[model samples]
Target: MKYLLQGFTMGLAYVAPIGLQNLFVINTALVQKRSRAVITAMIVIFFDITLALACFLGVGAIMEKSKILELGILLVGSIIVIYIGYGLIRSKGVMEKTADVNIPLKKVITTACVVTWFNPQAIIDGSMMLGAFRASLLPEEGVNFIIGVMSASATWFLGLTLFLSIFKSKFTDNILTWINRVCGVVIVLYGIKLLYSFIEIVKGY
Candidate 1:
């Protein structure tokens, strides 16, 4: 029970904050292609959960084998985060609005998979935080930890979908720009946090 609660809390912490993907989904929802956006969001969540499971099971042994391995992971993760943050900050453009648009489900899924899975920070975040945290619990508590992570993602998706649906009519390019800018700031903050952790690791070495 305790482990489950902890898992849920940790999941909330990791997923609740505004990030690049969150902004992407939110903007997608505001557009006429809500279905496509929702599908993309689901794809991201699916990959996140799968990676979480892999990290939970696969990385524990590596961590135990060598402290350097763990530090290296963190360093690499921090660099990726910083690079992503820079991209977001420098990004300047608009998503072209289209009417009578048709996007294939397969294409949407593929794009989302690339965006989510290719992100090194996402992998590290899941492996180091969600994966390791869940493994710390007893066998019976596994369900709860998984539940927590799933719940966090589900809640975000549902809430974002609802919000976009409600305000879809009011959303405009300007609103999207604002959302993107704010999300950019949040992403930069995440990058800074990651960099700080890397510095700590370096100092320890």
Candidate 2:
């Protein structure tokens, strides 16, 4: 029970912070159907949970075995995150259009997948850090820990979506631009952390 609380707290600390994914979901809620954003959240949650499970199942051994692979992934993920952050920082428009719109389900799914999968830190965070954390708990506590992480994920996604949906009308190009900038900055920090970790891993190798 204590471990479960710890896991839940750690999960919230890891995920509750605003990032690219959060901004994307918020934007989706403002422009597209709210369900679209919820779907995106579900996709991300599933990916995260899947990776966490892998880490819990000793996938960290593989990650630890190949320092070169870790370095490569870290470097690549850092670069991509930095680029995305730059784009977000310079973004001028993020508001919903006044025009009637129809967003295709395929595009929604594709966008969600690309955004979620392209993030290298997402894999490391889910499959390694959180997963490893889960591994440290007693065997009986493992399931509770997983449930805790999942709960945090669910709480954040649903909370974000619902909050944005309610006040979606308040979003303007300027407001969204600021939100993007903030999220961009946070993401860039994550990127920098990834790069630093990569360098450390490479040095150890």
The number of clashing residue pairs in each candidate reads: 0, 0
lDDT of 1 by residue, 1-205 (tens): 6666655655654564455566556656766466666676777678666766676667755654676766665555555545654565555535444422245667666655665678887776667654344323445676777776677676676677667777776655565455545545654565566557657757867
Instruction: State which candidate has the highest lDDT.
Output: 2
Computed on alpha carbons, the lDDT of every model, listed in order, comes to 0.60, 0.62
Worst 10 residues of 1 by lDDT: 93-102
- Return the lDDT, model 2, position 31: 71
TM-score for each candidate, following the candidate numbering:
0.59, 0.58
Q: Give the TM-score of candidate 1.
A: 0.59
lDDT of 1 at 133: 40
Which residue ranges in model 1 land beyond 4 Å of their true spot? 61-102, 168-205
Candidate 2: the clashing residue pairs are none
